[model samples]
Target: MYLCSTMKKYVDVILPLPLNGTYTYAVPDDLSLSVEAGCRVVVPFGKKKYYTAIISNVHYCPPSEYEVKELFAVLDDSPVLLPLQYRFWQWLSGYYLCPLGDVYKAAMLRG
Candidate 1:
């Protein structure tokens, strides 16, 4: 993956909410490395609490609907998760009939 300093790219993130799909956010220049996939970030969702979400992917296209927001903060200097971990969570979520956020919560509690 490219480092965060090259160009400011907007990313479309999938929050662990019961919503439709992804939301767009502006990635800050200084926070490039911190915004990679599997890294957690604080984002403003709706009008209330700032939700912690993972950056699923990065893109250049602007969102068509809602106004994209700036990333509030990145929660990690390096990715907290690996590809295998993500696959494991996906399997657990499917088998347990639970949300991915629930799995994330359980992992956090153990840590």
Candidate 2:
């Protein structure tokens, strides 16, 4: 069982867009168990399309700038991202001076 805490868990997701940052989504109690760093999830972005995003970070710290959006669905039963892979993505993002989202799309894209 989860201990009671004032701070709630939040997830930072990487979208396929070329944007430089990740979006924060609040994890509801029902979906908390299933969400993890490195899994792909479906989230409603903006007013329209729902995009599949890579779960890059999971933490208790909620973002201060904007209200977090709720996740629409989880696409993976298990984490598709390995811890090492996650680390590499971070390094790649910094080294290449490109958004992690772009690297993620390249890595996940299958022909």
Candidate 3:
């Protein structure tokens, strides 16, 4: 029998804003396997207004500096962007000195 790691799980999400980094969010029992990279998830930011964010990384390490919040909802049955596209976004952000979210915004808008 195989056992999953005991480490706490967290999902790094890229919000649809001009922000620089992905925010970590806690994964409730109901959303574990349903989430994946490049998938859209609705997450509450600040006091209100749930934003559709892209799941960048999902792993078994919870952040230590702040409280992680649960995902509001997962909106994609299939991933929105491929891993190659993610790599391109990373390049765009680094080369342009822009936020990954900005890259995502530009990518998401291109029909």
Candidate 4:
């Protein structure tokens, strides 16, 4: 039998602001079991602000350029945005020449 080993997990998230690309954050051990793609998470973005962002991808590759930040909180027990919906949003962002955050903003609009 093969033994399973735990690896470092990272999440790429789409912030609600008008941004171009996803941001990566490190998953703390306490939140690792529950954090996943499409889940909303609270992350500290700028020096003085924290934003609620949507997780777009989860993987083990750590970014080589910058120091990854730790996620503050997980907002959902399950995925809020489905995989299919994420692809559609990606298409919309590309076709419309807008930021993914813009697509996310319009899609998540509340009345």
Candidate 5:
């Protein structure tokens, strides 16, 4: 038998776009159980197109800028990123002198 986890918190995510930084989203009551740092979520970016973004951090404070949007869906049952992975990406960005989005694009293109 299988069981689903419960969600009880909200999170603010940082998308790798030119936009400012961090968008807030509410965790579904039932799905929050598996949500955590490094989890990837499919979210509506602008008008069309959904992008897979890593959950940078989770918080309870309400967004102070724009209205928070609900997450379109969770993509993984567990977090996809680890601390080392994040650090590596950071290092790559610094060494390459490029935005993280460039690295993400390269990875996606290869796939």
Candidate 6:
């Protein structure tokens, strides 16, 4: 007999706000196949508010500090942000001493 196992997945998203660090959200099984880095996902930000955030990383490791929330929805079937653009934003944020969210806001067009 063989044993099968499933691993829990999570994503680190970059919200377009003037805040530092990425937020980790749980990837529901239904959305796991669609979630990827560079893709935008709707997630709860604070009490009574939701925000569209860009996925920065996808992994199985769960955060040990705070309670992780489930993703609200996936905005794109494919990644809207290119890999190069994502890296550029990271570099710009680090070099300029600004938050990644600020870089993302300035780089992306408003909808």
TM-score of 3: 0.88
lDDT of 5 at 20: 38
| TM-scores for every candidate against the unseen true structure | 0.68, 0.86, 0.88, 0.90, 0.71, 0.90
Off by over 4 Å in 2: 1-7
Which 10-residue window in model 3 sums to the lowest lDDT?
Answer: 1-10
Candidate 6: clashing pairs of residues: none
**Maximum-lDDT candidate:** 4
Backbone clash numbers for all candidates listed: 1, 0, 0, 0, 3, 0
lDDT of 5 at 63: 53
lDDT of each: 0.72, 0.85, 0.84, 0.89, 0.66, 0.88
Candidate 2 TM-score over all chains jointly? 0.86
RMSD of every candidate to native, in Å, equals 5.0, 4.0, 4.4, 4.8, 7.3, 4.9
The 10-residue segment of model 1 with minimum total lDDT is: 1-10
Predicted structure 1, TM vs. truth: 0.68
Using lDDT, rank the candidates from best to worst. Answer: 4, 6, 2, 3, 1, 5
Writing each residue's lDDT as its tens digit, candidate 3 over 9-42 gives 6689988788988898887878887988889998
Of models 3 and 5, which has the larger TM-score? 3
- Flag regions of model 1 displaced more than 4 Å: 1-8, 14-22, 109-111
Greater-TM-score candidate between 2 and 6: 6
lDDT of 2 at 23: 90
Pairs clashing within candidate 5: 6-33, 7-32, 7-33
**What is the Cα-based lDDT of residue 72 in candidate 1?**
90
